[model samples]
Target: MEKVRQATDSTVEMPPATGRWKLIGPGIVAAATGVGAGDLVATLIAGSRFGYALLWAAVIGCIVKIALAEGSARYHLATGSTMLDGWRSLGRWTSWYFGTYIILWGFVYGATAMSATALPLAALFPILPLWAWAMISGLACALFVALNRYEMFENVMKFFIGLMFVIVAGVALLVGPNLGEAVQGLIPSIPEGSAIYTLGLIGGVGGTITMASYGYWVNAKGWRNPAWMGIMRLDNRVAYVVTGIFVIAMLIIGAELLYTAQIALSSGDRGLLDLDAVLEQRFGPFVSKLFLVGFFATSVSSILGVWHGVSLLFADFVRNHIKGETGISREGLETTPAFRFYLFWLTIPPMILLYFGRPFLLVIIYGALGAFFMPFLAITLIWLLNSSRVPAQWRSGWLSNGLLAIAALLFIVLCINEVIGLLG
Candidate 1:
């Protein structure tokens, strides 16, 4: 580990990362991970319910993700510290909070992601049951991430993300055009009786705590200075903007194709299967198959992303905190107590959740913690980057701060809504 200079000197003296395209690593992976099946379903529901009226919400979601992600990355570049390190600096309690939250979150999320990836496969080929396919997905992702080659993992993630973009965007085109109405959606408006979908669309669009894991991606890319900061922001904006467009395309398909249909989507992973039935009925077997393929791409991208990225975060947390080391050594990150521990944390315990299914209490806890994370990240970024720890050049600008403030309030509202939803 390089000696961590004082935060002040670290900001000024760090070597700038060379090359243009090379700096895009973590932001792309984070964007891929953040845009999952749930995000797609929320956009779909919004489009189906409100036509293009809720398109603005998708844009809001993208903007918020960029802000939060940029903040996280900024904290890392400025201080030469991971977000976990930044959190620990705030207090030992912050570390405990994150540790406990991540463990619980991983157990619940791993099952959810595996089942999500499985549902599409099961829908495509019903010879095997859903749980069996889910196990295969879990094992596959675990084995792949366990390989521990960062470049190889990023390439694989980019491939799946590309497939998801093509199929989902292709389907949107096949559904045909209503550019006049689509353009109108660019204007913000809440239609009658569509408040819930609007809220969901706004809140769910490509937003996830996994976005926080982007900094690790940046660090992995060897970007470690204020000079790399501009590239980082640009990479972040471009990624989430792609994420926004993908979501908007999905929403357009849902609005144009399914608005008049009387079908209802089941909540959770079942919803995608329900959507497959609709596709099969409306289009044909080929369309249904395509939808399932796209579903698998989206779900598996998320599974692989979280499996790899969050485990990296968990591992780094251990190396930094428990071991009293600096960032994971190049070799140590691949083979360390922290890395292997979170690999199991992500892969093993979650299989049990698959067998038992998601308990109501577990679901509630997941939702509660998940809802609170964006606000927490936003708040912490504001605290860390705006303080003496960050150089003025690396700090968030006024516009960025304004956006983060809005994001913080939006997440606070989401947390309240989640709590109320859980209680009900």
Candidate 2:
């Protein structure tokens, strides 16, 4: 295999052709990271309010994410640059924007992710207070990621994904989904007042910034050149296919069980707990407990995924911008002080927020930043993949461009709506 010199002053050897399907770690990590408790609640809400009405939205959401992830991976493999590196090449302003957004985003999201992970553990045990569980969850994930290297982290994520799939899919089956209605859901139609829900389902199926982290994860998995492109595509497909199934299963449960019962869940992560109560009442304690365990898996996996993946991004940002590093080297990033600093940033300070609660202004800023990220990502991806930034063969084709454009428009509208809601 030929080796190419990357900006990081390292040689990237083209991976040998083998069973590409076997190289599937990063996609699983991204998939697990994307489907948090919030996604489950959103799908449940959609199903309960308009049974199978927004199912097409979920499918489309997976497709959109697949394109985004693929573009990110393609950029890294083609140019030997991280997403942060690509953004930096766009301009220093891009670097400043991302650097600022990620810091603020991480502060607020740490608390949010920790709390979400804590909820199910608290429900299952009833021994620890929510705050305590939240702290423990944060510390536990921090230690796990801090201790393990990429391979170990990937394996752990795979276990969580499998556990979540079996439990959630099992519950959906137990709920007895109406197959005919599910099939009909493939046709697009928005019931009255379902426009926002439909859009949210389409735009918010799996993740936000985590989509960008897909490249970092792929890099961490040692896939460095265009030779890995086919494997990367397969990995991405399998990831979202799992994501689609997990989401569809939740919608089925909501459509069959909650929609039929006319029971509406409360908003936020609490809504998942409400589903647990309903599940216990409808089935038994065992099923409800099983669902909560799956919920815990989903939330904790996000914590772990973000802790590992985004930390890599942060480390890369610091390397390219702060340290004046031109190339992205895996060993350099993994061992850098910046990586450890961001890992600590993700873990410790957020625990203080867990105790004191996120302040009002910080939450507002976080919400605003979070709202625009998907649009920012989409537009930048279109620019990066289509421009001379990437090689001709590696550049996005018309179909990829079309999907990404549609994704950009969808997210821009969603960003506008979110901003309006925040201001309102």
Candidate 3:
């Protein structure tokens, strides 16, 4: 393939310039943020419960992410509008759904993200309490977002993503995972009693609401037009490819080590915590520590990414809708008051949840809404990207559409399973 060029324009109205790696920015961060503790737990659980039976699903998850991320990037490139702006164009109902979802998702996700970041910290430093570490993680992530330039955050995320991949891939290699079983998983059979977890792994590994923020990241990276479209696709593919490998490595570790050892994993993020213990038991304390460091890097990168990226998205939603500032002609959303307001919402109010712990009701609602968000994003992207609004040059190809449709269906099934699980 010919090398795709980068975007040159800083102003919102112009098309992004041509070049490679030149426009790298928050899109990568958003990708990192979308893969959090819950995702890891889901992937690891699939591995532990059924070895490499879901490995193919995990790879499929990566492709699904690439499609969604590409759709988001295309939306921004074609219209030079944020995804929020595109949705608002659809109608007020879209805005209402988005607004309510963000408020609820942010409130609950803040606690969960922090707790995840803190787990590795607590594991590394027993001197500090888990709650204390959680608070510190929250405050630190918020402060990082508030103080730093977007480029700085992106570089940090890139570094951590590299570190995460190295550690995870290394462990997977060291464990002698069953490649034969892993290959078979690509065919997509549903294992008995394991459908729920398998679906969750497929849906969860792909992305979260943060994936919708891909445009903002692209915008931040100076990708402002159709010229940058090729590079944007490459960037999305590379990021998810790396992410897929990391997840597959985790699954292999689960299969080779955890399954072989016969360790019964718990249900949520705690299962990952349990995995940490099992690592120590099987491979010695040093390997466990290394895994914890990788785990901490993964979680903290996620916290910082969400704190920064989605805050940008929510802020843009407010700026575009409530403030009536939409399109490329206006000032960027990052500097708008609505952006700061959501930033504060992400940082300050969630501190309450940090101390008090998420209420049972809030957790339940968060799970239900959270489970449904992927399907919503997929369906919305398909609708919005295919609409007349998107420039024909940047429209998704049939292959992309097919992948995204499969993504939407996978998440729909996952959402159904979640609702059933929650209700039952």
Candidate of highest TM-score: 2
After the best TM-score superposition of candidate 3, give how far the Cα of residue 315 lies from its true spot, in angstroms. 1.3
The better-scoring model by TM-score among 2 and 3 is 2
Q: Candidate 3 — what's its lDDT?
A: 0.78
Tens digit per residue, CA lDDT, model 3, 118-175: 8888889999998889888888777777778677888889888878879889888988
Query: Quick one: how many clashes does candidate 2 have?
Result: 2
User: After superposition on all CA atoms, how large is the RMSD of candidate 2?
Assistant: 2.7
Tens digits of per-residue lDDT for model 1 on 96-201?
7677788889999888888889988987789999989999998988888887578888888888888989888988898885899988998989889877677667
**Residue pairs with backbone overlap in model 2:** 7-327, 8-327
Query: Where does the lowest 10-residue lDDT sum fall in candidate 1?
Result: 1-10
| Residues 157-183, model 2: lDDT tens digits | 999999999999999999888889999
> Residue 17 error for model 1, in Å?
10
- Superposed by TM-score, candidate 2 places the C-alpha of residue 229 at a distance from the truth, in angstroms, of 0.4
Q: Pick the candidate with the highest lDDT.
A: 2
